[model samples]
Target: MTYAEILSHIYALGRFGIKPGLERISRLMAALGDPQKNLPAVHVVGTNGKGSTASFLSSILTTAGYRTGLFTSPHLISFTERIRIDGREISEDSVVHLAQRVMAAAPPDTTFFEMITALAVLYFAEEGVDIAVFEAGMGGSRDATNILDGLLTVITPVALDHVEYLGADVPEIAAEKASICKPGTPLVSARQVSSAGEAIAAKAAGIGATLYRCGSDFDACWKAGKLEYRGVGVTLHEVVPGLHGRYQSCNAATALAAAEVLSGIGFPLERAALVGGVENASWPGRMEMFDGEPRILLDGAHNPAGAEALADALAEIPRGKLVMVIGVMADKDREPLLSALLPLADLVVTVSPALERALPAAELAESCRRQGAAVEIGGSVAGGVERARELAGADGLVVICGSLFTVGEARGHLLSRPFEAFRG
Candidate 1:
């Protein structure tokens, strides 16, 4: 099929909606000859920070001279962003070719995510990657990416997200994410709330998997002027991880811990490579800022936990005022998200991201209004960002957030105008 035809076919499958089971994915993999078998991978599971941790692991593996494949979800701009080999996104031609092949072989009722997961595995296997890192699409237990028996499982902090599919409470949600652990595999987790930690530990114990908690086992910190990583009796000093945001320091540490664990299991990872990898890992749309008089910051803070992190990060930057351009998905709980973000905004402009699931701009504005936030309705991302920029002029700041869909569109809007001061 052509690229447009391929994309239309894939997106059309969204009508099937999120099917939370592994039966179809397993069947699809079998039909494709099980490309996932014998593939060394690191499965990243959590409510937040999954993409960042996966990016760190991919960077570390690649820096150590290994070919690595990275697969993430919900592409911001292009479908090509989901599959990457050694930091390079899958080419459009490759995507077109793979989509046609997989669709022909897929079983009836296969989902968009499952088909994409199969596509990634096929590409990684064909390319002969040394390892692949996968971000669990949602709850880890039955998520399509969980079909792999990754050598190491990295669980970032667990939070309440995708409640309809995952679980309603933090511990229950944690249990779902913890299900990614295979028998006797090494699992590394970031600092989770006590209940989440307990649930994860319980799940790991039930499965005979070795659990390593952040504060108790391995951790990284940016303290006293350097990045200090302590993991598996290996200490790395004065390191600087490539990603922005203070939370990323912890993510780098998680990646380091996984690297050290891999080394114990016979991966020839050198010290220099670990140091270089941390310093070079880059994940866009976390706290990405363009240099300008009034800098534009794009963060994919769609949920409460992510929005809280964004608020903390925004608090640190020295700006005259903060004008936020926001959008959200209809499924996300807006109360806590708005509570966490409104307190930091001098002005809020609500927009509808270019997506089928985006919450209505007027509804978002009403939510902000209820919360006592000074709000305006921009209706669209481009218009919202323009309005925010106008409010934040030169000396202030325009922060675009609420969802990756919003930030993605804002990035395009800002990046396209060559005359905009924020343009690179």
Candidate 2:
């Protein structure tokens, strides 16, 4: 099949929606000769920071002379962005070939995520990668990527985001994420709330997995303008993180610890590889900024916890009046998400991304109004960007956020790039 035909075939499976169990994926992998079991894997699961940590680790491994494959979700522009080796996106021809292979072997009622996960694992295995980092799509226990028995698991800060599918509270949500831990596998995690920490600790202990919490086991922080990372049996000073924002320091630390674990298990990484990897890692659509007369920052902060982090990061940067261009999914918890960001905005330009699940611009503006924010409907994502730039003027800052779909559209518009039509 051609690229367009193949993409349509895969996107059509999205109608099956999110079936969170691993049965279908497991069956599909088995039929494909179990490619997932053939490759060494590292699983990164959390509400946020999964992609960044995975990108950091992948970069580190690649720099250390290892063929590393990185699999992430919800590509900002192209479908090929979901799979990469050595920071290069999978080629369109590769996607077409892989999609055909996966479709031929897939079981009945395969969801989009399931098929995509299978395709990634197969591609990595066939390409003969030394290690592949798999970022979980959603909750851990039954997430499609959870089928792999990873060398180690890294959990970024667990928070309440997917309440309906995962759970309603932090503890319940943490438990679902903690289930990614395999027996005897090392688990490295970022500092969590008391409730989330307890749940993750309980799960790790029950499974006999060694747990390493960031703040307690080892930590990373900026002291005197240099990144310092302290991990199990290793310490690095003067580390430089490639990504922006204060929160990335924690993510770089988590990736460092995971890399240390791999080295301990005979991966042969040197101190230079660890430092260089963190310094070169890059993930788009998270704290991404485009500089111009009116600077535009694009972040995929759809939940309250993420919004709070973005707000804190914004507080440290020196910028003029803040104009927020926002859009979110229909099922998200809107009130708390908006509450964290609304106060930071001098004006809010609401928009609706071109997707089935997006909340209408008018509805989002109403919610912003209820919060007593200065809100206006910008109709579409592109319109929102234009209106926000006009309102922000030359010295002001324009922040586009609330959903990855929104950020993706704004990014495409700003960069003048064409993204795939089916972004479901």
Candidate 3:
């Protein structure tokens, strides 16, 4: 099959509507000869910060002279962004080739993500990568990517998300993520709810895995505009992660901790490499700022925790006024998300992302209205961002957020012109 044909075939699997299980993935991978087992990997799972942590880890591993393969989900800009090697996206040619091979090997029925995961494993194996960093698409346990036995598993902060599939509470959700840990593998995690932490620890013990908790075994602190991380008798100070938001300090430290664990197992990453990687790593659609006089900030703050971080980041920018353009998926916690952002905005423009799951613009505006914010409905993401820019005037700032879908749309619109052109 041709590349277009391959993509069409893969996209057809979306009809299955996100099956959360390993049977299909396992069967599919087995048909593909279980390529995932041949590649050394670091699996990252969390409600938030998984992408950032995976990107940081990939950068550091690459800097340390390793051919690193990174597989992440829910791409902000392009589908190609989901797979990469050494910071470059998978070429169209490679995608087509892998898709064709996997399609031929896949079971008669397979989910889109499962097929994609299989393709990533195959590509990583073919490229002879020293390590691969895989981000869990949802909760860890039954996530298709969990089929692999990774060298290390990193869990970032777990929160109430995907409640329909994972659970309705934090502990239940944490249990699902903890399911990714394999026997004897090194597992690392950030600070979590006490009950959730206990659950994860119990699971680690049950599997005979070495569990490293952040606050207890390793820690990080921010001082003087720099992040300091201490773990395993090594300390890194004044480290600035390329990704913005104070929350990123925790994610960066988590990635560093995982690196230390890998090194302990003889992976051996240079200290300078770690520092440089953190300084240079970048994850788009998370507080990404476009160059302009009235700077436009874009973030994918779809949930309450993410919204809180976006609010904190907005507080640091010195703008005369803040105009927020937002869109969100229909299933997110809209009330809390609006509560986190509306209080930080001078004006709110609500819009619907170009996705079947997007919440209606009218409904979003009503939520902002209930929060007592001056709101307008913009129908679509482009319209919302444009309206926000107009409302911001010459010296004010325009912030676009709520979902990666919204940020991706805004990015495509903004990239059409030179960055200076967006300036007020």
Candidate 4:
């Protein structure tokens, strides 16, 4: 199969929708000769910060001379962006080959995510990666990625997103994420709320998995113009992340702790590699900056907690009048996100991603009106960014955020080459 044909077939599998169970993936992996079982794995699961945390660990391992495979979701520019080894994206030819093989071998009922997860593991094994890190698509217990018995499990702070499938609150959601804690494995986590922490602790203890909490066992904080990470029996000072956002300090700390666990298990990670990796890690579409007269910032702050974090990060930056270009998914909790972001904006341009799940631009405009934030309804992603840039002028700042789908589209427009999603 050619790249286009492969991608078209994979996108068509989206119609099967999100089947939130591991049975199909487990079977699919077995059919692919159980590639996941042949490799060492690290699992990172959370409602937020999963990508950043995984990116950090991947960088650290890659810098330490290990053949590290990083698999993430919701690519910013391309489907090929989701799989990388030693920071190099999976080749288009490889994607075509893998997709064709999976298509031929997998069940017809396999969902998009399940097929992709199996493909990632198969590719990682074929590429002979020393280790791999997987970010779950949803709740860990049933998510396709959970089929791997990862040596180290990192859970970033659990929050209330994906409420319908993961449950309606933080604690319930944490329970589903905590299910990734295999017996006797080390589970490292960010400092979560009381309820979330309690659930994770209980699950870890019940299964005899050692639980390492950020605030309690290890910590990372951005303070006084520097990032300070103290974890894994080492302290990093004056660390600078390649990614933008003050919230990244916590993610860096989580990665450091996870790397330390891997080192403890006989994977040698040098102190110098740890320092350099944390400072050099980059994840796109999370506070990504594009330089110009009117600066562009793209962030996928799709949930209320993420929006609040984005707001705090924005407050810390020195920029002129903030103009926002926004779009959101229909099932998201919109009120809190609008409350968190709109007030920080001088002008808001509302748009919709080219996805069936996206909320209408006019509807989002009404929500912004309720929040007392001035907004313009831009029915197209490219049109919305243009309008926001016009509103921002030359000296003002334009922030594009809300959904990953929205950021992906806006990024394509600004960069002059969009990622081909299912719609494209």
> Quick one: best TM-score, which candidate?
4
| TM-score: model 1 vs. ground truth | 0.93
By summed lDDT, the worst window of 10 consecutive residues in model 2 runs over: 415-424
RMSD of 3: 3.8
Give the clashing pairs for model 1.
none
Per-residue lDDT for 1-424 in model 3, tens only?
A: 6766776677778777778899988888888888887788888998889999999999999889889999998876666788999999999799988888888888777888888999999999998988999998885778988888888999999987788998889888888888887788989998888988988898899889999998989888888878898876579989888998888888888888898899888689889988988888999888899867577998989888888998887777788789999888897778988989899888999999777788999998888898899998989887888888888887899899887778888887887621111100
Candidates in order, TM-scores: namely 0.93, 0.94, 0.94, 0.95
lDDT of 2 by residue, 63-140 (tens): 999999999988997898889999999999999888898999998899999999999999999999999999988857
Candidate 3 segments exceeding 4 Å error: 417-424
Between candidates 1 and 2, name the one with more favorable lDDT.
2
Residue pairs with clashing backbones, model 4: none
Q: Worst lDDT window (10 residues) for model 1?
A: 415-424
The Cα RMSD in angstroms, rounded to one decimal, for candidate 1 relative to the true structure is: 3.6
Tens digit of per-residue lDDT, candidate 4, span 1-424: 7888888888888888877887788778878888888789999999789999999999999989999999998787799889999889999999988988888888879988888888899899999999998988885689898889889899998887678888888888998888977899999988888999999998899899998889978898877868888886888888888877888888988899999989999798889999888877989899999999799999999888889989989998778878999999898788988899998999999999887889999999999998899888989889999888888888889999998889999888887885675421
Residue-level lDDT tens digits of model 1 in 1-424? 7887888788778767789889998888888899999788889988778888888888988999999999997676667778998889999799898888899888889888888999999999999998999988885778998889889888998887779988899999999888978889888888899999999999999989888888889877777647888877688999877877777877888888888888887687999989998888877778888878688989989777788788877767889988999998898788998999999999999999876688999999999999999999999889888888888979999888988878878876776821111100
Candidate 3 or 2, higher lDDT = 2
